[model samples]
Target: MNQYIDIVLRSVTIYFFILIALRIFGKKELSQLNTADVILILLISNSVQNAMVGANTSLISGIIAAFALFCINYIFKKVMLKSSFIKKLVQDKPEILIHNGITYYKTLARLGITSDELEEAIREHGLEHYNEVKLAMFEIDGNISIISGNEYLKQTHFKKKIIHKNLAGKK
Candidate 1:
């Protein structure tokens, strides 16, 4: 019974410690999950699990893992700030899946994104044809960025026109 109580208290305490550690990790830590962040999270969770379970995992191990994670993040951020090459290596370059209505098959294959997936992505943006798309960028985070070729040519909305007219009148 006492052992069960100890386990419960330990779990609760570790849970709060994780929350605090995550907060210290920084805003970008959760909002903008990069490759390194994802890897760290995977490792941290595994380490914490071991910490939660006794025998193989110890309380000290959990605290050490948390501390190590925090240190690594701090060091990496410092390195990234000073080095552009390190930044590029850790933060992957965006891929160009489609350019000027023509699809980059090799790029898509390399990204493992199928034609159907590409079509679905573009279609979700309310785009009907590839010709309407001027530049379709594949972000490092696996997000599709679609820009219409006619964006500049497209007529301004009435709301924008009215605002412009009102500003002109004031001027």
Candidate 2:
């Protein structure tokens, strides 16, 4: 096979594999970037670099591989926008975490979100208690969006706090 064609095929394969892997691992990984998450992303890119370019280390080969990746990514996004089924397959739907101040335990468990995390999200929205939340959703982007029941106390922006140490004094 032509080296350029080989590069294109390899790039496309790697792209699809990473996409499926991210989807299977859950969307939460995409939303929050802790130290480990950042390291993992860097390592993944390094590891896949050789797989995409193979034994060809020439500057042209590398450029071709990169161009192929960008092309496919653009095409994929366009297809996703035009096709609802493709969009649904590629993106996660928003999940209701709380409704009318009632926490959906099942949904929380399924999403691997603990109560403490939910409480923190609630507090970040300026709500003192879960009952003060009118609606809370785990958005497709991995953010927990909260709607307060008290119209007067509604908050439009939430600031997420970075905790260096836990309650047990462990990092």
What are the C-alpha RMSDs, in order, of all predicted structures?
Answer: 11.8, 5.9
- Write candidate 2's Cα lDDT for 87-160 as tens digits: 99989999999999899999999999989989988988888898989999999999999999898985766766
- Scored against the true structure, residue 155 in model 1 reaches a CA lDDT of 28
lDDT of 1 by residue, 1-171 (tens): 454444545555666576567545433355446699899989987776755545535666556545555655677679979999987656657788788899999988876677887886677666778777788887755577787676554422112234676588785
Clashing pairs in 2: none
Top-scoring candidate (lDDT): 2
* C-alpha lDDT of candidate 2 relative to the true structure: 0.93
Q: What TM value does model 1 have?
A: 0.55
User: Which run of 10 residues does model 2 get worst, by summed lDDT?
Assistant: 162-171
* Local lDDT at 34 for model 1: 68
- Residue 151 in candidate 1, Cα distance off native in Å: 2.1
lDDT of each: 0.66, 0.93
